[model samples]
Target: MTAARAWWARIPDPVVDLVVVAVAVVDVLVSLEDSSRLAQAMAALACAALLARRRFPLPVFLLTLPASLMLDIVFAPFAALFTLAERSRDRRLLVVCAVLFAVASATPWPLDDLSSHDRTWTLVYFFYTLATAAAPVLLGQLVQARRDLARRLEEIEEAREHERLLHSQAVLARERAQLAREMHDVVSHQVSLIAVQAGALQVAARDPDFKEGARTIRSLSVDTLDELRHMVTLLRASGGRATELTPQPTLADLHKLVTTSGIDAELTGELPPDVSTTAQRTIYRTVQEALTNVRKHAPGATAVVRLWHADDGDAFGVTVTNTPPARPSLPLPGSRQGLIGLRERAELLDGTFASGPTGEGGYEVTLHIPTQSG
Candidate 1:
């Protein structure tokens, strides 16, 4: 199939015409009478006219028609050979060939001093021969048309498949980015809390309450390490196996997060279970990231976190604010990723999140999430 298609790609109309004319000239020479050289010469010229079929199909037909008519009168048996060379791109050329064939076949000719009945039989034979010679060219045109249509359809399907693959890749890239942001927010908040409690423990080692502070720091560190391990395992697993990891912390876990952050949080609201879960998780992460930001970038600054539910109880909000340290400068290491991850989490749940320096020289982070029932 490949070779045939390659060959067809290189085939110009002129090449087809040349091949046809060459074949017709060979047939004319072998079948025509040698004594009538003038008639043979006319037949050869008529066949040669076919070489210009691509450029001047009508003119070639007009030139060949009279020669064919003369051949039919002079050598009736050999006249059909010229009909094969009539093939051209123009449909009008076929019409000319048909008219010439009919006229040539119907014309009378003197053949070996034959009777009128024998002459009529020879005319019928010539008509049948002309029809047979035209069949292959007509069939070739039909086949070429079908091939062209098939090629176009294949190209369209290939283009559509390529577009679909590109669209799918784009969606997967976006989802992966969102996943990375979520993981960063979750782990960084836990790590920041551990660091702050450890520092406090070191500074207050001479005091009696240092033991209690040290114990708390150790517990928070262990819990954070376990959670981090589970997240890593979940990420590595394939298929349904990943679901074995502990379920994500939701609204019910907000109190634990705030307490671990060493913050006193005030919460008020009666939220639907599903909405409460989503809102609580989003708020918890936001607060965690905000506190981490404060401890690293604004040490010695106290933090406040407030959670509220709307009157209708369909929406909830959280706000975390903290004053800057005595000397404000660049943010803490990994602080940028925390806020970015929190923003992505909020957007995924169709909520709003914002964090920036407040007018009172303090940083404030806020989140609002809508609750939806299962």
Candidate 2:
């Protein structure tokens, strides 16, 4: 039943008016009962005036009133009264239209007849007149009330949905801050200790190869510690001076990032002459994520990083592709959230991201981002 009513509601007003006109025409034809042709035509025309009721309720009601005296179709005045009452919130207009409908519908029956009849019959006719006139206006009022209620309910539901989303975001934010603190307090400290031990070993070792290896480990550990601290600061500050709190790596920093990944990375192309910090950061993260995946999943592979202006200089593009691992090695532990974060970052900028095997048993990640110019 609801589905059917919803479908009916979808019908346009003009189509609804046409359907009503057809029903009114059929009603007039059925009740002809020896009425003159002119009377029938006037009745049909009065019913047709219902189409204009929405646009000009009072004018159409005035048009349909006298025609009711000829054909005596109750609905013509009733429909007009309904429309007038529904369209206006003005009590005076509604009352005036209701009185007009009563007068129009009860015509050809003398008001003085009430005085000649018994009290019982007089009361019956009086109630009948008032009831017929009031029914349409009352129905219109009911419909208006339902519509207002529905609108308010929708608004309240929307507000609730907004509040729920905000609450979820708040909870997620708190959890992220807590996680950042843990990483800094526990994991970063441990890594720094390891780096310090490697530095001590590098200083004391006699063999040049052992010293070189220790120095490499210490350098990598120190870089990791610095990045971890930067991340924690970023999370703690949240909305306040993020870039100032911890510097975000831009395209200019790709050389150092590639070097840290322990892979021979070839970088090409340039960012737009004047790019936004956001676009630059997104581009940097995309490359960073791709490089991290390589180090974790395919540690010994060489990578190629490419950057180019796409879409006629309206957008920037980055491509990172690496060959499969050189030989078997211990798999690096990872939660593998880097690629997902990279994808989300691209989407936030209305950009595109894709990563998959290159059909050569090699993995490739590609990103396209819009620059400030576009």
Candidate 3:
């Protein structure tokens, strides 16, 4: 049955119609002595009409049914016509074709010479032929329906797979952007600190009282390099592995972060560990970026760093504001990715971050990160 359906699907309607004509011709040849040549010719013509079944099914059925009835009297070969009608999607035409077939099969030709047994056998032959003709048409319809359903299912699966691939690519792009921002923030701040301290070391080359300052500068450089290495390692790890970002600078390191920028600053706050870590990093980077901006574009500007924590233990905030020099002219050093990185870090910990010019000849950055005790 499977193989037959497969074959039927491939066979065009015109080819199937030609096959039906061949079958009709063979039937006429077998019954030539009993049926007239003219009657056989008519049956062949009726079979030929079925070629139009796909394009004009109702007209084909109408022409073939009556012709089948007329030819049945001579050779009783109307069964093929009934089969074509059944294959048609129009069921009303199939019913009409069935009625005509029944009439043609039962009607007796040259009745004067026919006997009772001959009539009964002829009626039985007609009924059997009609049933055989209808079988394939019904089966073809079922097969076509199944093929349609399978095609639709394949399309749906392809669409779903496309959507999944798009979603994965979008996630990967977001992660890459976030990583870029983090690198910019870390590298820019550390480089700015090194530059400022290097200048201080050069100015105090022969002064013993400034030896401690030189040592601090050397220690910060080594620590900065270590942090840079850690960031690089984190970037290399893949497949959702926990990133080994450096032990993030917290409130404890805020003093060093401010002093390294050559900024005279003060800090005050009773900060929780989690909030303090997130806030400290955010503040350090913000202040570092701001002070770097000051040194590059507004040299000789003084800056103030403020740390505030609420006693209710709900929130911690840090603000860094810096004034511009009288002759501010140097272009800002580093890309603007630092503030973006700060905002992303704050958001990752469900915190808030803001930065802008204070409209008082200086820039200000504010960060607030919430904390919970374990």
Report the Cα RMSD per candidate.
Answer: 25.4, 20.5, 25.6
Better of 1 and 3 by TM-score: 3
In order, candidate lDDTs are 0.61, 0.75, 0.61
Q: For candidate 2, what is the lDDT?
A: 0.75
User: Counting only residues 3 or more apart in sequence or on different chains, how many pairs clash (N, Cα, C under 3 Å) in candidate 3?
Assistant: 0
lDDT agreement of model 1 with the native = 0.61
**Pairs in clash, predicted candidate 3:** none
lDDT of 1 by residue, 92-181 (tens): 656466556556645544334767797788678767756754564466456545554464455446545755996786566556445544
Q: What's the distance in Å from true for residue 215, model 2?
A: 1.4
Model 1: how far residue 174 lies from native, Å: 4.4
Backbone clash count for every predicted candidate, in the order shown: 0, 0, 0
lDDT of 2 by residue, 1-374 (tens): 76986998999999978876777666666666777776777777778888898999888888776666555567677777788777666767787777666555555532244344455664565467767778888888777666655654554465467669978877876887788879988999899999999999999999999999999999999999999988887776662235466556676887888777556777877767676777778888888778867755664578899878875777777899999875334434567688889888888888888999988778999888776522
Report lDDT (Cα) of residue 158, candidate 2. Answer: 53
Each candidate's TM vs. the true structure? Answer: 0.38, 0.56, 0.41
